[model samples]
Target: MGKVLTQDAQRFMVDCLKAVGAGKKPALQQAELLIEADKMGHHSHGMNRLELYVNDIKTGKCQPNNECKILKESEATAWVDACNVLGATSSHFCMDLAIKKAGKAGVGWVSSKGGNHNGIMGFWARKAAKEGMIGMAFTNTSPLCPPTRGKQPVLGTNPLSVVAPGAQDELFYLDMATTAVAFGKIEIQRRKGKPLHPGWAQGTDGKITVDPEEASKARILLPLGGGEMTSGYKGFGLAAVVELFCGVLAGSKYGHHVRTWSLAEGGEPANLGQCFVAVNTSCFAPGFQDRVAAIMQHWRSIEPTEPCLRVKCPGDRERRNKEEAESKGTVTYLDSQIKSSAALAKKLNVTPMQVTAE
Candidate 1:
């Protein structure tokens, strides 16, 4: 297995998936989405997730050939069924539809049910920002976080993301989970046999935990705040709001009722729900770009706590990361990760690459 740069690695990944049965366009899109995550410095949601997606396909939890359908539509909203297709494909389809509707109606909302993990939410939000619209997306998942005072994992790491387009170069974006950390973060630590920081999660009995492996099995992540006293209650509140939209509004499973991503034991998709909304700014104001530019300029002018660093907007770091990866021609991968990816490739009858392959 190799830790090839983002571009080459994604090309290989798309080719491998296409060879295995995914349609050309769908495979390519999925590969691009994952690689983009790596480039943006979020490895937990990047290629590491490809193994899960591929496994889901092999186990029949995610069908590469399934087609998503719009079950209902209205002037400002729609409901979609993924038909158990790959999450990336269904999410892209829905976001594109939402953008189209928003262009016509000034705003559009789309709710999707019966889909699996869709990777990072930023990818979809950025799609709308690129189209000159404000984009927002939210999703619910299997229980991974605990409520304010609970020790049991009673809530999904339900996440929300938003993107607002800027003038010419920058975009404002935010993507975060309702919990302090996602399951993937814990999983990564567990794989490395490392200890997690206190307050990130709680043991089964509601005690703070530091052992990642133990934490994964018996602990639940604390809500946005570690102990209720901190402002994490605000985060908890927002998380609940997302749950209402993704679960209650969509009539999907809520809180502890959701299912995990495992498939080997006959586990299927959690029938997760997601919400996507797009707002066309041109309908609301003329010269929106100029307005955005002025606001960001004012923000940057704020006195820096450290003179070496300048105040930056939300999307700036990601753009910088992408540029570095492109120029360097390679992205880093953990040694264990490369090995695991090799095993997966072999199991799927695909040839794995070396890091320095010409």
Candidate 2:
């Protein structure tokens, strides 16, 4: 493992994005998105994804300088064309719009087409939460997860996030991929020379496999519950719901129509779909934040099934991770990540990230 100062990591990401043709604001915004993932302990979406963004820009698949436009709007809803901008730019614009509309209308819904990969969905959802409203974010990606009992992938991980702010700085935050695991986890395991855990993926033969290489090659992720008997179909259903909100509603690439997930190749623009929603709690109830905080506290007070492992509320782990990273002022990366980032910097002719002593 290698440790890097948080600012250095952000700078490296910004530099890499700029080197690949992204403008200053777009690059910095995108880098902020990636760095937040690292701070929250989601290594898969952090620096791990920098090369993919660079490739997208290099191949002209993403136009970081382009402007997003509203195609249609009502009192509480909007349809946006992201115009193939960087995911951070598009997501910030949409979520900000949602929050603004919710301030007056009590609820806001915005669906967008032509987005690129947008780091972690939770980051976007938390934006409205900070404004004392309930927030939701969803996005469609390249197809990588198979429906329950199916051999072929028909949906992306199709992540969703919901966040609500509470009193005393408490929160109810839930963000998850519909699949058993995000594809980035598989890539991380492969990078670490590790095997997959059972129930995570299937081989090309459609049977469960613990081999990371096989899982990566097959590109078939299981639904969250793993198999038919385990109710994996529930997760499959959730992925479909996200797709409905994103691709189907937004009229972008949907389901199998989405492109393949790849790092080495850039084809047509992803034209991916995304959705954001905000609901002003003040419109429906008073003391909303107090109630939310109480419930989270109650959950934490529950008896643990294992004494050593206490029960926690939805956002506790991520909050703890962020606090720890902040206290240290550093993020840790795998040796492979460090080496690859160095190679990327050399390729882009940008200054490499400086590592701190562990």
User: How do the residues 28-82 of candidate 2 rate in per-residue lDDT, one tens digit apiece?
Assistant: 9999999999999999999998998899888888999999999999989999999
For model 1, residues 73-183, the per-residue Cα lDDT tens digits are 998898998777777888898899999999999998999888778888989988899999999999987777766776567667888999888886768888888888776
The 10 consecutive residues of candidate 1 with the worst lDDT sum are: 261-270
lDDT of 1: 0.80
Clashes of 2: 0
| Cα RMSD for predicted model 2 | 1.7
Instruction: Estimate TM-scores for all models.
Output: 0.91, 0.95
Off by over 4 Å in 1: 183-198, 209-217
RMSD of each: 2.6, 1.7
Model 2 spans with C-alpha error above 4 angstroms? 184-198, 210-213
